[model samples]
Target chain A: MRDSCSRELTCIARSDPRIIILSGDIGNHMFDGFKAEFPDRFYNCGVAEANMISVAAGLALSGYRPFVYTFAAFDLTRCYEQVRIDVCFQNLPVVIIGLGGGLTYAPLGPTHYICEDISILRCLPNMTIVCPADQAEVMASLRSSLDHHGPMYIRINKKNEPCIYTGEPDFSLGRAQLIQDGNDVCIITTGVLLSEVIRAARILEERNISACVVHFHTIKPVDEIMLREVFSRFSVVVSVEEHTLPGGLGGMIAEWMIDNRIKSSDLIRIGTGDYFLTHCLSQKEARDHFGISADLIAGKIADGLNK
Target chain B: MALAAKISGNKYRSFVLMSDGECNEGTVWEAVLLAPVQKLGNLIFIVDNNGWQATGRCDDIMHLNPLADKFKTFGWNSFEVDGHNFEELLNIFHSIPVDSEKPTAIIAHTVKGKGVSFMEGDNNWHYRIPTADDVTRAKAELGLE
Candidate 1:
């Protein structure tokens, strides 16, 4: 997904002269094509994420579209003040590309794992959060970011993520993409976890339980129309994500359901617990440990249907 | 912004006015180290050296002495001037891009509160709000009676 983002950014910069890339001393080789082609547009702002964010805000204020790229853990948490004040406060057009979203860097330990990015960013005004499911979604989101008016946070996985879309599906900001149609249950997911959710849906289908799969690439400004439709149509709606349960997609859906008084369906949130994982594990192992793996999600959905 | 102008081939310049105490933040030095490498000649940073921070004197708190020399060491074209003097400020502003390939930094020596007898150089004014009588006296001190 990160590689796809770089490629798409380079493609976008070819036509948009206002496009500028700012990195926090990362992605040196990944952005080589962009730098070679548009030398003046790429800026490696050194190991200073805060300064990079502020500089991006300044560039945005001056009619330039600046994309600040760095690790998901450091990009938002490390320079949160800069994003809130310099970028979101003024509602600038700065696209913050957060690489290694969720537990993609699980082998690197908890410092690199970012499960709270969606939680923190969703509360800020003028801040839009988009967690693309795969390389296709990453490319689409990057393309959509060019026209997005306010500050946007694009959370992406590292690499070799399974492609959920065979072809480029019709993509837009703040709209959920329906991957499959079913009636018994709906599995709503965001980010790379969509692959796991799809697998779970297929598993449920084999058990004679029809499960719908919806991909919520955009967490904030959620697809309310889809939410209303899913909650009204399905008896059990499950939200699965690689992030923590609080203030993530699941939490956001829960709030939306309550505010709209949609009591027809029971929402089951599948994600990491409140605590961080102390043990070192691989991404797959970490997902299993957090009960967000395919098998566990399918089992949870089946149990919800039985109840 | 200066880098944006340079990349887009614009003649516009960008100025950032900061307080002396704000220099204590690590991000300030992070930007200080970067602007020179980018050769952002259109960028100018003005530091209002008021000699005091929130709790105590700036030097006593962080020891940012030789601040101008610090920017010079970091590859910026550094300058100093009396912040209160209009002519000095105008002269420094007119001489931007001192090296034509380096960012400019001006250390403007200033009092905490200028043009007022009671509030000048008083760090208490950083957070304290003046009473009505104090405001009247302040106005009188500034010859606004």
Candidate 2:
């Protein structure tokens, strides 16, 4: 995902001279190609995420489309206040890239694990949140977000996750993708969890249960039109993501359903329950423990529907 | 600083007005440190070093003593001025440092609640809202007829 971002950003910078990239002193040589070519445009902000965000806002307001990049831990938690006041409140066109989103940094312990960035950023007005499902979606999202005239948060896993989409998606800002059609149940997924949810859908298929797999890459300003269609088509709804239960894709969908008066017999949300993970586990291990893995999701959904 | 460079160059410069407590934030240091790297000659930071923070003295809150020297070390051309002296402020702002390699920091040494006799140097005034009588006394002291 980080590679996709770098590739797309370099592509964008080639055409648009106003595009600038700022980092919080991480990503040692990930941007070597970009730096060698556009030295003036790339700035290493040296572990000061808050300052980098403010400076990005300042740069954005000055007719430059500034993208602030950093570890997910610092990007969301450390510079949240700066993002809220300087970037979001001002409604500037600053692209915030939070790499290693969710449990991707699980090896580094819970300190680096980010599960609530989506919920935290959603509270800020004029904020666009995009958690791409795969590499293709990442490039498409970066292209779409470049022209978006407001603040955008792109949550991406670090490297080598499952690719859910084969080709470049149409990738509008606030749209959802229907991966499969079904009648028994609907499975909605966000971020890297789309891989798990897709597998879960296939598992349900073998059991004579038709499960619809929908990819909700753009969680904020969600594709309500698509969501409405899904609610009417399926009886039991399940939303999954490698994030927390509250203030995430599942939480937003639940709120929207209640507000729109769409009632489902059963609504299941598969995510990290509201608790801090203390153990130092690998990404796969953490997800498996938290019931966010493909097998766990399949079993949970199958059991719920059979009940 | 980049904003200043992009929009109007040296013609329309930018200024940041911050309090002494703001110096405690790592963001301020980061920004100050980066300004030189960009060589933002049109940017200036006016630090209101009033010697007091919310609960205690500025010394107790953070290690911001000799603020000018700290800014200088961080690549900014630093200056100290009596904040109450309007002429001194005007003179300093009128001239940029000959060392045009970086941005400038003006540490304005000020008394808290300036011109308010009772509130001057009193830490309580930081949080206390001035009452009607206090306002009247303040106005009378300043002869705001």
Candidate 3:
């Protein structure tokens, strides 16, 4: 995630010299390549997340698009007030890339968990929330974010996930990409969990359960028009995500369904269910434990259609 | 009225006592605080001792105990200066030899609404902006007439 962020920022810095990078005592070593490429554009703001956000706001006011990166928890929650008042509230165009969304840092304990960032960030006006699926999606999202105005929150995973698209797919702002086609079920996925959803769709396909996969990378101002189109195809819609069921992709999809009066036969949400996981585990293991794996998702779809 | 008179009369310095209502209400307190910091460089901030907010009071909303200590923490060289002493107020402000680096705070110990015939140490005035009659009475009491 940091690699992609640094790369995008470096590319943007080459063209737009006003681009600056601020890290909260981390990412300096990882961003060495960026520093080497654009020496004047990088600044490690130490452990001061609040000060970094404030400084980024100042830099943005002075016509610099400051990219602030840090661990998801400290980056989003620790300096939430600063992001809210200083950046989003004031409509500053600063890119805040929060690394390790969901339980990406599973073994690192609860402090590292980023389950709440989506909800908190989405609630802010003029703040664009993005959770790209994979490398291609990352680049596309980064490009879009750079070209975008106002504050943006890009939640990224820690490890390299599966490649969602072959190359740079056509990504539009607030538009969902329909990766597969099916009539029985429509699987809406966010973040890197799109990989799991795609895998689940293939598994469901073998069992004669036609499932469509819609990549909802952009959370806020979600592709409601695309959703209505997707919903018309499938009777049973299941929203899959790495985040908790509440205030995540599932909740957003549910809200959209409710608002549009699209009453699917069954709405199965695959995610963490009201409990933070304890005991060290990998991302896959954590998803499995929370009943959000490919097999579980496939089973839920089949069962929902069957019922 | 006292504040207006002091400002209009060309007084070199003045003080503003406030409650938490002024602080949390928005930039009114910030503007008030910055006015002194930006202005006289000699103004003193005295937050009245009777802790009160709106529904309950200061201790109810949030106990800011060692109140004087909190002001000191606000980049202001502050201590508990006296409340009712004309001589103490004069002496305290006179004795504060200015160090331009830090602003000075004198948390004067005073009742919330002191020297009032009816209302004294009351939280009602926190949000109640003075009316025409209230302004006239306040002006009369402060010798503005």
Best by lDDT: 1
**Which residue runs does candidate 1 get wrong by more than 4 Å?**
B1-145
- Backbone N/Cα/C clashes per model: 0, 0, 6
Greater lDDT among 1 and 3 belongs to 1
TM-score of chain A of each: 0.98, 0.98, 0.95
Q: Which digits, one per residue and each the tens of the lDDT, describe model 1 over residues A123-215? A: 999999999988998899999998899999999999999988889868999999999999888899999999999999888888898989999
Off by over 4 Å in 3: B1-145
Models, CA RMSD each:
18.9, 17.8, 17.7
lDDT score, residue A112, model 2? Answer: 85
Residue-level lDDT tens digits of model 2 in A66-113: 988888888778888889999989999999998988999887787788
TM-score, predicted candidate 2 vs. hidden true structure: 0.69
- Candidate 1 colliding pairs, count: 0
Which digits, one per residue and each the tens of the lDDT, describe model 1 over residues B1-145? 8889989988888899998877866778889999988988888999999887655577765658899999999999899999999999999898785448788999999988788878998777875779999999989888889
What's model 2's lDDT at A16? 92
The worst-scoring run of ten residues by lDDT in candidate 1 chain A lies at A43-52
